[model samples]
Target: VERMESISRVNSSDHVAACQRSNVIISLIDEKLKYRDSRAKDFSAKCQGLKFLPFVTKPAGFSLNWKGNYFKMATMFSAAELYTVEHQDVVCLLKPILNENSPSFKGCGSISLAVKDFLGLIRKPTINLVLNQLKEVANYCEDITLYQENITNACYKFLLEAMTQNEANKVMITAELKDCSFILVENTYVDAAKVAFHLNFEAAPYIYPLPNKYKNNFRELFESVGVKRTFAVEDFAKVLESIRQDSESKQLTENNFQLCRRIISEGIWG
Candidate 1:
């Protein structure tokens, strides 16, 4: 019984030591994991194009003999190349570094503008591909939703404008400026009439007398003329709120779906 008791005590001591070692290992691993996660987050935040750095550096170079024009050209060319590849990661990275306050960001606006013009050259089919790629990058970055939205809107607008212009200038131009189309009246009819009377009695075209009551009604009349009416501020706010809610719901559904898929794949559902 004495020998048995001694052996049991030794075994218990070994178990305790093993547990302590296991805990130490786990703590070390947790620390390493946390450091890795922090580094990853930091990296994602700053991942912009590498080419802009040299141009920014040149102005501040020890020689102090840098040509701004050459720097601008180089940066513009780099931006054009990046834009062609639809490298939004580079663009996002470039934004903060090129800000007005940043020493290196001086020529950034020019580079950015060049990139924007380059993006204008992208065809419709390629625009969607670039947008999806940007979305994936934005999702991974997580905090760039505003940037993503801007990029998406810019791409969409560019495409819309390009398509509209192309259609308008087509060889078989079927586009018509239909009657009742909204026209911008610079001044009130009375003001226009007075100006006309001052300039030439008969040279001015007949100006319709706009009533004071009809000033507010002009917007309604404009709409009646086939001009697409935009939502009022309040209505637009509600529309945006609805869209936000829908997006949140969709994201939740996607997360749930992913979780279920993972569980099934691991045989946890069985």
Candidate 2:
């Protein structure tokens, strides 16, 4: 009877929390829709003949490179220095209390209630459930790339409308337009907050230097798997051949190929 009561209370609390989160998400969606509608109206008014180009559903050779020049919308605070988390100093203050090894700690040390609940939910085979939920939230968010792309497309449409036949031919090549396609370029700049996240949360714990002889081979092997590139078992075989005195592939079985790949991966991570 008591266990049932306790479970009922817990379920009730969860229901309330879930409702609150849903409400917040709904509110966000409403705001986003309102803002997007306003932007669309404004854009339509300015560029009456502009037609939006649909992006490829499955884009190939995608990569995020931080070293690039890109335009940014102006704001009161610098986007580069903007902090996503609020009240960061409070976390610093509670660090000592949260530290398990600290002498000041007296109570049973465990992960925060939120993190514990999250880890519990994720530990189950709930990846699809999690992804669907994330996708719902993601639908409300504006992709910055698409936003900039719309502006650029609108500008080009305006230019095309104003252009003389010869000028348009020189610029766009109307007859050869079917053959002309764009390679999507994604420009990115890592901000201070994201940099800190990468350093403190996402970085490898340790990195050992590669030997002088293997360093160049390792770089080549890594780059071989990059955009518009291919890497085969033979590529790594060449590396092995260079390393071995005999330069033979007698023991290079499927298992050995996997093992060699793992070794290369670990060396790269380190």
Candidate 3:
């Protein structure tokens, strides 16, 4: 009974803490302010006209890379992508965590969680879960080789298929696909939040910033994937915090510098 009570307390407090954090994110939005995209109606029309496959779903979890000049969206899709995850960037991130002797992360929650969450997506996979991750291998356009419209067109096709098609039709579309049609582009920043009210169906957005917003909601986004990154990111945060504390203490000695170097190197380079 004591153990059960302790478990219950942890769960209850975790729930409350999670709710408080969500409230902080939502509170940033003004209820009276809705995103108004002038081109949304026209964009929706163009989106509807794309030659989409039968069941390819709309892009969720959209990411922004402004310097790349092309916004990249992970075409999070069904298991059509089988042989690609190995070649993607997970190697650079996952390898260090899995290292058995790494003091920073050997038996850490981040390593276990990352293995549990990401390793299985490439191993045995499933599609029924909420926000199921598929692949990160997008054909990146270094320049404006593919016009912005083409990528957006694919997104619209995904939207239409996601909203309009039934399960049966979606299954049939897969059989009709000639190749991974997404070989043309990675993702586009179509502003899922800005155009939410204008989508054909009642679509819930994954990650897109509201228009005319004063600041980018970077902190809120970290919250979205906190479960996966909590272990890893917390370690990174601790290093920075240690450095700040050391600096404040006026202890800018060689020993402190070496400690910082070890923290940085052992955390990532191990």
Q: By lDDT, is 1 or 2 better?
A: 1
Which 10-residue window in model 1 sums to the lowest lDDT?
195-204
lDDT of 1 by residue, 1-270 (tens): 122123224334453332233233324434544565555334221223212221232223122122233333223222222332243332332321222112233222222332233223232334334333333333332233434444433433333333355543221111221231112222211222112111111111222223333334333332222333222234323433444565685654554444334334432222
Whose lDDT is greatest here?
1
TM-score of each: 0.21, 0.15, 0.17
List, residue by residue over 77-189, the lDDT tens digit for candidate 2: 11111111121111111111111111122111222333222212112212222222222222322343553333223322322332333454334323222222211122222
Scored by lDDT, model 2 comes in at 0.26
| Residue 244's lDDT in candidate 2 | 46
Cα-based lDDT at residue 203, candidate 2: 18
Query: How many residue pairs clash (N, CA or C atoms closer than 3 angstroms) in each of the candidate models, in the order given?
Result: 2, 1, 1
Candidate 1 regions exceeding 4 Å error are 1-144, 167-270
Measured with C-alpha atoms, the lDDT of residue 259 in candidate 3 is 56
> What digit string (tens of lDDT, one per residue) describes model 3 on residues 97-213?
111112222111112322222222234222211011111112333343332333333332342344244655444333322122222222322211122111121111222222222
Looking at candidate 2, the ten consecutive residues that score lowest on lDDT are 50-59
- State in Å the error of residue 267, model 1: 38
**What lDDT score is found at residue 118 in candidate 2?**
22
